[model samples]
Target: MAWTVPGLLAVVLVAALLTAMARGYALRRQLLDQPGERRSHAVATPRGGGIAIVVSQLLAYIGVGVLFPQAAATLAIFSAGLVMVAGIGWWDDHRPLPALPRLGVHVLAGLLLGALVWHWTGEASSAGFSVLLAIALINVWNFMDGIDGLAATQALLASVAYALLLPAPVAGLALILAAGVLGFLPFNFPKARIFMGDVGSGALGYLLAGLVALGLGTRSAPWTILLVPLAAFLVDAGLTLAGRVFRGERWMEAHTQHLYQRWVKSGCSHVMVTSGYALFGVAGIVLMHVFTWLPSPWSHLAALAWAAAAAGLWSVLLNKVHR
Candidate 1:
């Protein structure tokens, strides 16, 4: 525990260094994402800077495996799944891949993570939830990552929230995740040096699912509390997807239809939208701590209430900005 701050700093440094290197690699390889009508950014930028975060987190997993040999097998399984998700994403970033094959790899990775959840808690329900969480988060993150700072910043805040709720080992892992994102944030936020790419965003979702699975397995807190930190993104991404589907649109097609994207298009700066979402995240953290102290049914009720409030706010904002 005493070494946590130092360890976090070390990982942050490693992630920053790795991100810088990833940027160079992308530029050298001419892996550029051009600005487009369906896109958010205004200029061409090197993608896949997320490889740095993936590499940094994988190294952290290795260190954990070495320190706790008993946990190595499970960590190995988790790492394998992580590789699948990141691997597909990395490949896609270099050469565009069809959605079905990419979804297939994501499903496989989700199953692997689901098995880890089952192994941890022996609960089929929890395992099922992990699978869905993995798949949902992977794509949700990818969809929401349209703007500078939104995806990574949300992840950093959520990881910090989970770290506070989980036990020591997993908590430390969460902190390390937050630190790695922190390291990447400087290069991303306020201005874009390099995008997180599919590699980073998908892997990030899987990594968060891993944390949620561990938290559920350990009974660190109520499952509802675990959902709090993710409320904002789920609301935006879920509603946007549903809207597209209801309108008989190609739901999976890349588009700037998300609430955050609309906000950006409505003349609000990326900083404003990101900061607004962050306020909700900070509120979620505060609510998580409050939910911890409440009785069981009440805590669950409060989480639902907060989520409803979030959805309501999202609707109001969406209508306002759509005008």
Candidate 2:
């Protein structure tokens, strides 16, 4: 898809309309939320704006698919799978869904995404790994949903940067999504006029997992290297959650224990921390591109080291901010 000026204009216009309507709908529906003891924002804000991301992606899929029917079913399955997660998440936002049911929905969506990717790719070695990766990614993304603009920012970066790292079908679908998140972030960042709610974050997590698996299917990029766009979030969330479980905390409960959350609590502004994360993502993706030409499997190790360093740095900065 060589994007001409008209194509770019179409994306921006569609995205802006989607964002404006989402903001209006969330506010009108009294879907706004307040800053809680566990929340990073200090003001009441509309929270269901992630619906705009869902809407934009669907429209783009239809527009793109009609031009390229080969991708129609693939986009359909991708949208259908992600929408289930978004639907459950939106319902929970309006009505507090019980924990068990939500988890069940997540599992079902994850399973469906895995099944569709496997069916489409017909790749054998990827089956179990896709399911496992999908679960890990969904949870990591959920965990990363701590600060304003963080999750959406990362999604935009992955979608944009994947152009070099991923193949066509996976890349096109992901870019469509990336554009939506990019359009949404302005309303989500800094002072936080609106939030992604669970609807945006959970669905985003599920979609990213599916796309990443699809991107790496036949590509020879080391598993660890490919994960670089998000390794910091994974490490922080995985370790923190596991530590809480070991300490007898109710792991199912939502709390602001994530390192970024703590950093904000320690007194960093949301802009500073979120900006740091965006820059870190850019660096990681750049590194991945730089190392792809290398011969050794150890290039992945460099990324892993960088990820660990980032996690440690953020933890230290957070504690210092706390003090």
| Cα-based lDDT for every prediction | 0.92, 0.76
- How do the residues 39-61 of candidate 2 rate in per-residue lDDT, one tens digit apiece? 77787888877777877777787
Which sections of candidate 1 miss by over 4 Å?
A: none
| Error of model 1, residue 43, in angstroms | 0.8
lDDT top scorer: 1
Query: For every model shown, what is its TM-score relative to the native structure?
Result: 0.98, 0.91
For candidate 2, the TM-score is 0.91
| Tens-digit lDDT track of model 1 for 1-323 | 66667777888999999999999998999999999999888999999999889888888878878888998899899999999999999999999999999999999999999998888888999999999999999999999999989999999999999999998777888887898899999889988899999999999999998888888988987788898999999999999999999999999889989999999999999899999999999999999989989998999999999999999999999999978
Worst 10 residues of 2 by lDDT: 1-10
